[model samples]
Target: MSSHAPDQARVIPLRPVPTEPTEPTPKEPLWRDVVGDVLRRERLAQERTLKDVADSARISMPYLSELERGRKEASSEVLAAAAHALGLGLADLLALAHGRLAQPTRPARPLRSRIAPRPTETQSRPGDVRLAA
Candidate 1:
């Protein structure tokens, strides 16, 4: 009964406060892009064209070009064929990709992995079905 006036409610802000800027984080490269780089590098090193490699691999030039441009995700068979066409084994191709992934182009780590990482403690992931070979 002695108060001069009732307290008014303050408005809450919808936006969050800005923080200090930090170094930008690097993103993980896609598997297709990594593989495509290897393929293109090898082909160019050997002085070959897309049509030549595609012909030897028994795939359409457009398809091989797409693969080299990372526009498509090649199957195991197609990858093997392309590798063989380039005088490289499937293992060699994969090794090149692994090396590329291990290289550090930026200071920050990738948010997600582009390839299978080293073994870790078994943890169940959604839609993951382990198969014993």
Candidate 2:
């Protein structure tokens, strides 16, 4: 029989352990994807057709379509031509892509300390080797 009363006895509730907030690995956006997305968005906002933009940019319609779908990486000259056709400069296009990349969907992680922790005694000594008898 317990001597302590129910009120006085210690009671530990079963609760989930609090853990560090884990963020899923963010996928790095490819340059082609960023460029294609910006180009598509700009074209759509202007209510322009693929053919019109391609023709004005002096590029093939198929190639422009591929670029818009992020299936093809465009050369700097092609990007410049497309940007010019859309009344934007290469810098403007790159800036738009940079902006998209800069926006974060999750909280930024804290930077880790540059200095590593000292090894514990359990860790093997440097250059120490043992052979079985």
Candidate 3:
């Protein structure tokens, strides 16, 4: 009975085990992602149809849709045309993109804990100025 119990306790491995632990790679946002987000946000805020913008920009609806979805990398001229169609200059589009990139982000916390003041505020200097002259 003792020998049978010892044999039953031994388990056979069914799959190969990794010798080392693997680290997950962090994902970085692509330029297309940033630009697409800005464009989509602006379009939705203005309550304009994709077809209207595409016609105004002189680009095909499908192409414009692809661009807005970040599936295509548009040329400078195309981007300018699209910006113009949306009543925004190339500079304004780029500025909005830069602003999106400049936004501060933090790891998500529970709602209760998130209500607490941020650590940066406590450690910030009194005269710290963010604006450029």
Q: Which predicted model would earn the best TM-score?
A: 2
* TM-score preference between candidates 1 and 3, better one: 1
Which lDDT values do the candidates have, in the order given? 0.82, 0.82, 0.74
Which residues of candidate 1, in runs, are more than 4 Å off?
A: 1-21, 107-133
**Model 1 whole-model lDDT (C-alpha atoms):** 0.82
Q: What C-alpha lDDT, on a 0 to 100 scale, does residue 95 get in candidate 1?
A: 99
lDDT of each residue in 90-128, candidate 2, tens digit only? 999999999988989677655443223444555544443
Every model's TM-score? 0.64, 0.69, 0.59
Clashes of each: 0, 0, 0
Cα lDDT, model 3, residue 104: 57
Over the stretch 91-116, how does candidate 1's per-residue lDDT look in tens digits? 99999999999998866544343333
Candidate 3 ranges beyond 4 A from true positions: 1-26, 107-133
lDDT of 2 at 21: 54
lDDT of 3: 0.74
Name the TM-score of candidate 1: 0.64
